[model samples]
Target: MAQAITAERGQWYKRLDLDENFEVVAIDRDEECIEIQYYSGEIEEIDEASWELLEIAPIAPPDNWSGAFGSDNRVEFEAQADSLETALNMVDNSN
Candidate 1:
């Protein structure tokens, strides 16, 4: 019997039966299919039926999202700089 849980994009889930963690990357309702990326960088396409067949539980995102990528791929994401007016507006001159 399929579980009541249905896969949704951007959600993390653990497959209890296989002890594997996967993230739902994309869903195509028109195609009735789902794309999942495993912790080991493996991408698999499964139909909705197959998704429900798995014993999965919703889980918090893993501590390290770079499980699939190598050290070379690890890079810090920098915040974009604000506009000149925005930056000037935040200056403190209450001395």
Candidate 2:
């Protein structure tokens, strides 16, 4: 199933079509566009159609979970990180 994004300011998203990561800077409901700041520091306005190509960025596991794992489950922690990277790569290659 596809993930749902709230599209709020400061939220990060990965553009599936471009393999680029961007953060939401603003949303113009009247214009139906979202202002995004790319990882490269470029700002652009994307319409609803363009927004459809984006997915919410993967976030790290919660601090409490990490604390529970501590150092004994280093391999499992790495695997989780790798999984997120793979998911992002899949999104990039989808287009």
Top lDDT prediction, candidate number: 1
Model 1 lDDT tens row, 1-95 = 74779787667889898899988767899999999988888889999878778889999767665465333423321122143222222321211
Worst 10-residue lDDT window, candidate 2:
61-70
Q: How far does residue 90 in candidate 2 sit from its true spot (Å)? A: 36
- For each of the candidates, give the backbone clash count: 0, 0
Check candidate 2 and list the clashing pairs: none
Per-residue error at 7 for model 1, in Å? 1.2
True-structure lDDT of candidate 1: 0.68
Candidate lDDT (C-alpha), each: 0.68, 0.58
lDDT of 2 by residue, 40-87 (tens): 667889897666655656433333322322245445545555443443
Give the residue spans of candidate 2 off by over 4 A.
Answer: 1-4, 55-95
